[model samples]
Target: MSKSKNESNGGITAYSVKTKTKNVPMIDPVIDIKSGRYIATGKDSEGNKMAAILGKAKAEEHIKNGDAKKGTGWD
Candidate 1:
């Protein structure tokens, strides 16, 4: 990205992120496996439900350790 004039002068400017914020659903999603649907359940430190594959246990542990919340809030 090209630097703005203010940036060149050491002045910081706020810019919006280029991606939309995605809200993870609270309910554990049911994935359609060949045998049946698998339901996932877990929460982040802030209590935000995290049911995505590949880090549920570790993320939940982090949440309990301080990286997340409890109940139903977002981090």
Candidate 2:
């Protein structure tokens, strides 16, 4: 998985933020508009692109069920 350099240490990940602690992954993910896979949302710590094997199924399911929509109002 990739982590942005700006990602705060011990801070909440985009995945967790999106799911609002509802059985979500622990990384920032980008949904591929074509394949619907969960790829890394930002650059890795080393500034390279990344994808997480751990979050794919869950993210896909979330997207399919429209759980990816709406805000948790966390911001």
Best by lDDT: 2
Colliding pairs, model 1:
45-68, 45-69, 45-70, 46-68, 46-69, 46-70, 47-69, 47-70
Tens digit of per-residue lDDT, candidate 1, span 22-52: 3333232222222232223443334544443
Error of 1 at 64 (Å): 2.1
Q: What TM-score should be assigned to candidate 2? A: 0.27
Give the per-residue Cα lDDT of candidate 1 at 68. Answer: 31
Tens-place lDDT per residue, model 2, 1-75, is 765432234222343333233222334334443244344343333344433332545544544554343222211
Instruction: Report lDDT (Cα) of residue 65, candidate 2.
Output: 51
lDDT (Cα, 0-100) at 75 in candidate 1: 33
CA lDDT, every prediction?
0.32, 0.37
Which portions of model 1 show Cα errors greater than 4 Å? 1-54, 73-75
CA deviation > 4 Å runs, candidate 2: 1-28, 36-41, 53-57, 60-75
Error of 1 at 17 (Å): 6.7
TM-score of every prediction relative to native = 0.23, 0.27
